[model samples]
Target: MVAGERLKDRYAVDHLPLSHQGMGEVWPARDTVLDRQVIVKLTASSVMDAALAKRFRREARLTARLAHPGVPAVYDFGQHKGRFYMVMQRIEGIDLADLIAEHDPLPVSWVAAIGAQISSVLIAARQIRLVHRDIKPSNAMLERSGAVKVLDFGLAAIHGDDRYSRITQSGDSLGTVGYMAPEQIEGSPTDHRTDLYGLGATLFDLLTGRPPFDGPTPTATVWHQLQTSPPRPAALRPEVPAVIDDLVHALMARHPQDRPPSAAAVYEVLAPLARNLPPIPGVVSDQPDAIRAYAAMVGQVPLPAHHETRDSTTAEYDDPDLATRQAEARAQQLATTGNPRAAARQWRELADRRASQFGEQDAAVADYRLRAIRLHAEIGEHSRALRQLHSLLQDRIAVDGAGHPTVQAIQDEIAKLTQGGLDRSER
Candidate 1:
């Protein structure tokens, strides 16, 4: 391929890729059809394994599903000359890794802002059941507008989808060293929390000008990720706050269960620290950024309410059973209309009523409790969800043996919630 060489007679790409890594190469291209500069990533022909091709296609589809400003928009996907290529919105900025190299020990507020932005993206990704398995600094771009865009979902995994085979065999790790969580290094089942650990390591690097752990060899580095705890950020930079240090440590906890409950929870802690950000000399401009200004206005828009109250004089529920049925109907209406917060509240109330009318251990009451838990989780209320799950688990274990499938399913939910930082105490 050469400069001006057209792929599918539409995208004219440069002769050489902008960057080439192990699995693929990213090229700068002009989409003649759309008349825009876009990024085209192609899998390396030498390593075009069937599974890899499937994963590449999966990445394109998964990335396309994410509709957030923090993520690049996918434009097209097709095969040219037996190689798969995906076109995405071109992001003009330096990656976080390069930014860190040029300006290490970045301003504290800048680090907080970047982390918080990434967390905001993660919150969206988690809700959609997508996990970015690779989340190192190189996978994050810092635009001139000071917005952080997370890239590289090539290794992303969908929750509970096993149609695609595992990329790594037993005992083989897949992510970049230093950023891999302990479970990742051990080849254990992973979830959204894995990304949090990577974010923690990246933030540590940004604050200290070096990775939290670096060994003489890759094998040694993997070992450190599995067995060692990183040094405190305050130790390297005295200006670091104790609260920030603690948050970073919790994020990098050896056990996933020890980390914060969710990305939303992490954002809550970082939002206050992200104030008064100091601009990077070259990366962030001093002039007012139109993207930032536009985003501020868009975020302030309120979502339309889905719930409406009926007048007491016109209400028709005269009996307890009828009122319970009406409440359940309202809860379902709210849930289907995309208002999980109000839906969760209604479900909880229904569960309480069911428990009082029948019994705490009644099957109908348990069902209502489960619905409440599901609705809470849909709205990023993992802490509340975990509390309800624990209650359901006790009832389940009493009715079924510990090894029973239903009992085990509840246990799995508990583990996932806790590992993502939503333990019983969080309630």
Candidate 2:
């Protein structure tokens, strides 16, 4: 535990000099019991309202239920010294807002790819009956591996028919002003489509380097989003393709029904455009060879294969402790190299060795499996990737729902593979 921090006695805190949007401060921490790196969000006691606390607790629970690459994983939650706090996965990357701000007038293709990525998240959340309620540039974080995560679910809503009752709270809008859908402003019922609208608005902001509706006040912006039909992306940046402009327009439809049926649909519409996306901002190296090399090396670690012993001469190698240690080693090796195939092979070996030791189809194993599929795709082994992707889609659909974005994304990837290959050269 670090000294001078008030919570050091209770938690092993490593102060992180980062803050965002008055949400609260985040500290890099380790759970003394678990001993793993985590980001702890601490709420100041001064703003502890009973209703808000309840909502925060609900947020923690809701976030934990969502297991997708695009959403941060919540580890634990508790109240210490009258201030509520939640520990979550410490993602390594930059928020889209800062990326866009530093590189204004972002390329159209990059914007489309971002839209596709976020839409995948919404698809996953929607499948589980959760609405993020907020989908802005700041809320999306881009990881070093090029994966995107949607964060800050403080105002998210779980599925319920009475959308008005679920989100309305003392007349204060629950989402970011510029990104909020008009239905949200009118205090009308909302559904998964509301999130779609917000995502569209975010893409618009990123591409044009301006919010879709900027006004003197949030109220005015809400009115503008409600009443105005935004200009096309090509209008703002003529170099942008008509297909992309069509996508943005479809996403920003005033009527929920008028928007794309689902985030998966949005991804399907944008996947091709993503092929033309420019290199990400602040990425140090945007060249194709550099990107490919990094992709290949991500999570790369070497693992030595264990030899099986002959029946009479060898000790029955089924010792639970030994098997467990070996499994851990293999998993670590896989994670280190970021090579899904190697990880998958190791996990399969672990499953055979310690089937009873670890629960069947555990998340750890599933993660490895998914990684293998993605890695196969990354390495241009599309057929193999498709096989794993099929199984992954089946598993997620069973656990979550067919509509889940993770499942849908697997399907989208499969579609892409079916058509051709994973050859995209950032313009």
Candidate 3:
């Protein structure tokens, strides 16, 4: 591919390449048909075998199906001069590798924000049974809007042609040195936990400007990943919080099973720390930031599960006495597994259903609502708890008078939520 070249009479390629890798080179181009800027990838002539061609198309389809803000959208793909070419959305941002170089030892809040965003991408990919074998700073782009995008989804198979798809003929591994998990080093089977380990390595670097284990050689790095234990982030940076340090350890555990069970769990831990972000000068601008403003309102309250209720159990049940045994079982499991927010929401859902059948003054309805209000206060959402309590108080007074036992219980909850807060016994 040369400067001022045209591909399929659609894109106009630039004179120079944006970046070059083992299998292909990314070129900054213009889609003359759409009159928009786009990124075009041209594969190397030497790597254009029948198998690579098939895998390239597969990647285009897989990436196109993702439909996420964090993943770039593929526009077109076809062969040009016996080399495969792919046109994709042009992302204007600095990759995390460069972001770290600019601000070494980033603030804990920024690290948590980026990590949580990547975890969200992983969770979405898991739903489709797609695994991002390689996850590192270079593949994570931090957009100017303070959003993190996980790049190069399913690109590993394209990176490793037929000969090195799983393992090389020379018995070499097929993963990144610093971020590869133990199973990858051993040439064993891998799953989403493998990506979790890579996330751990990425977060460690973000917090300390270096990976958990830094070895001189590739073999040395593999040895450290396999045998050595990761050092505590707090030791390197005393400001690192203890909770985040422990989460990093759990993510980087040698055994995949020892890691956090899912990406949602990791997000729950990271989301709390992803607040009050300090902007980096020259890295991000302040004007017209839509995503941040949108996020501010989204997390203010727990959204009601209208769609879920229609599918799980609804207020329009044929039998007024029917009990949603399945929802009850799920609520118990969520409460027992350190997910009080989800459990509380489930109980609130139960209260609404019971209220539709029996009156709002029913003892069963009051019990479920009280459980949710307490759970909300325990998590420090005192305002939401108070609002719920006041609404319940008015409903009870209208039905059973102001001096009733249920109305008094609701008043007491409002006082506890507003004044000294929930006691140890209440929590």
Candidate 4:
């Protein structure tokens, strides 16, 4: 589905607005029957096949049977005008990917908590003989109340089914390049352990702000997954606790047998670091606490020093405070240590707190926002930085008009990103 295109003349689902795209376009709509907001996922048949459609419907039914707090409730499923669609509870909150992209290399506790919660969901699915063939960050969504939801059961199947073997093989080569397991890349039979590997990849991306392996092509990426042993998460960031490092490596072992036997086991490992009791298989825990953990970890960091001139127009920017000065010093120290991921994380926290304490319109708020954007870009959070830049540019343009210098600068950055101006380190 193209960006900015509106869906027309749909009755059961109203107000269809395209929300995102990759495998398909997700639209936010109201289910008139249920009188609730829902997400309808639509994909062009040319890009999807009959086998894939069957898998989608089957997974939807399987998901409907699941009553876990971490899984989105599937409401309806059908086809219309040759476009396949499924209506599900509208998920809220950013995906872990977006969180990491907005704020890179999240804190150890945050990563562990999210990993444990998602793993717990898988553990529940395992009881019903379902395996989430795909477990990347894109499939995870945060709820408005702050709980995480594991989504996109489009690739899921009953544990032993070979019905999707052919399509899964084809699709595996095309999607989620950085998270596939060796067995998956080899087109071998997959089990719950395959999902574990993907979960590990997801966690690694959150903590290091980058996938352990990257390649110029999908083939090359598969080769690295098959042959490489990525550095332990803490090796990249020494401050990461020892338990997390050991657990992540164990989950990411090249061989399936080497990983924890089940998601329940992974949750067990994460429990202590998370400092919480394990989630009951199907119960929803209080969400505020989870949000606090998330806020603490992916929370925006502080901005570096801005060479302030006497800006008499804005009271907030007239002078810097001791807090801002101290934050700037801390940012510089982290950046200079060659651990920009850590630096980015720190800046995010300070920035978020400052924004709350001050006001959104404050010049200091804008400064912190810009600093977080630049640091995220430097730390390899391209999608996340792009979103932040878009929001900032929109607000600045609204207040200062399209021709303002700040607006122009933002446009220039967007153009550079679109043209691939920034260089990513060779992995």
Predicted model with the maximum TM-score = 1
Misplaced by over 4 Å in model 3 are 155-173, 294-302, 305-427
Q: Estimate the TM-score of every prediction.
A: 0.71, 0.64, 0.68, 0.59
Give the candidate order by descending TM-score. 1, 3, 2, 4
What is the lDDT, from 0 to 100, of the residue 97 in candidate 2? 91
Please provide, for model 4 over 315-368, each residue's C-alpha lDDT reduced to its tens digit, 9 standing for 90 to 100. Answer: 222232555688878887988888776777667777676644432434455666
**lDDT: worst 10-residue window of model 4:** 309-318
TM-score of 1: 0.71
Model 2 ranges off by over 4 Å: 1-10, 20-23, 32-35, 161-172, 276-278, 284-427
Any idea what lDDT model 3 has? Answer: 0.79
Q: Each model's RMSD to truth, in Å?
A: 15.7, 18.9, 19.1, 25.2
Better of 3 and 4 by TM-score: 3
Which residue pairs of candidate 3 clash?
Answer: none
Alpha carbon lDDT of residue 143, candidate 3? Answer: 82
Instruction: State how far residue 119 of model 2 sits from its true place (Å).
Output: 0.9
lDDT of each: 0.80, 0.70, 0.79, 0.69
The better candidate by TM-score, 1 or 3, is 1
Q: Model 2, 35-111: lDDT tens per residue?
A: 66678887746666766567667678678867786899998788777778888999878898987888887776677
